[model samples]
Target: MNAGAINETDICESGSQAPAATQFHDDAPAVAWLREAGLRPTRQRVSLAELLFDKGDRHVTAEILHSEVLEAGVGLSLATVYNTLNQFTRAGLLRRIGPTGSRSFFDTNTSVHPHFYLIGEDTLIDVPEPLVLEQMPNALPGHEIARLDIIIHICRKSRDA
Candidate 1:
């Protein structure tokens, strides 16, 4: 082996390749989640929702969601996920994030609160109300105060740190 050869162990420690895909369970509980949210139960809707929320509160873009769907062997088109997200957003089951552009994200937490984006690791964490919002302005002049949102982007130090 060359003295500077790449460390394969650093990439795949198990010494075996990970499966390229996974399949999810499509049973009654998934249906109940949809209905509990007052969303009309449909196979496609339930399947994707189960994938999105089953792992707990997380943010995902349509592309990420679509790829996850494919990884799960759902065999649905990306367009379907996009459309479903739009509908779900309208239905108040999911929140449409990213006013930035195509790089949108779907958040499973519907509650009124803020989020923390770990920019370095590309992860999002829900910041509870007390940590930030508790200190917010209780009253805004001439503003009806429909909602309040705060996004804190974080980054970690590289090896230099």
Candidate 2:
């Protein structure tokens, strides 16, 4: 497997650019999830989970993910892809980011922390973990913050004016 490539199995083709199909291994979470979640281990879901787990510490847009699946010739529909993503998100396996620019990205890591977005470059950087630990939000009289998420958007300065 290439440095960033996740081993995914597909009925599509053998020569896709992503990587080769990988068999079940002790460490692959896909295999474990199948066993733990009572899932039947369908080829599509397994392939998706493996990619999610193996991609470690990376954010990916669904389009990019679908392209990879299609490149592998998995023949999965976009709706199915979205459905599976929503299922995983509900299962606490993924974090769904709302509209960021024109694209939405999925963060595989569940551990909470702030994020910085460089709008000009469309780059996302995870804020250092320590910052989250030190700051606590003040609560209102009637309601408290159920979740604290910090996303900072950034942009580069243009030379004009």
Candidate 3:
């Protein structure tokens, strides 16, 4: 198979089989972004990247993205979506956030900042203000703090007064 092509033999990180054939669309920005991130610009990857980054920085779960792919008439499995998201995260092209439970949200914005989780809507919103940490606790003898994630859960206030 040529570069940027997705064939049946291309196995996803989840160990699931990929689609038999997928048309590769020429997405210049997505291709350049993937190359700069040191990731191969596969057909599925380019399609998903376009959908993820075309609009703007936002958060999306694998399931949500799978639904979107299906809606866009692209044949991609949920496992593939999960695998691609993880790959993008490892490449520093995306950030993963799991505020609670087993659900994971991939954010296109990789900047260091806090987030507000809308409990009712099950959505995450970036906190505009800069997060200030007065002091950070020392790490263990051999380990150092790699990163910090802060998620503030919010819900609509009850109107029954």
lDDT of 2 at 102: 73
Worst 10 contiguous positions by lDDT, candidate 3: 1-10
RMSD of 3: 9.8
lDDT of 3 by residue, 49-161 (tens): 99999989899999999999999999989998998988888777788889888888999987666899999999998998866666667669986555667899999999994
On the 0 to 100 scale, the lDDT of residue 120 in model 2 is 81
The deviation in Å at residue 14 for candidate 1 is 47
Model 2: which ten-residue window has the lowest total lDDT? Answer: 1-10
TM-score of each: 0.66, 0.67, 0.80
lDDT of 2 by residue, 1-161 (tens): 12112122211222212222444545566878854643445566687777667766867667777887888788888776776665565555666665375766777775565687778877666866545244454568875444444678867777893
Measured with C-alpha atoms, the lDDT of residue 110 in candidate 3 is 77
lDDT of each: 0.66, 0.61, 0.79
Query: Ten residues in a row with the worst lDDT in model 1?
Result: 8-17
Report the C-alpha displacement of residue 154, candidate 2, in angstroms.
1.0
lDDT of 1 by residue, 1-161 (tens): 12123232222112222221333345667677766755666778877887987898888888889999999999889998897887677566776556344467778876655677777666667865555222444346764334445677767777988
Candidate 1 colliding pairs: none
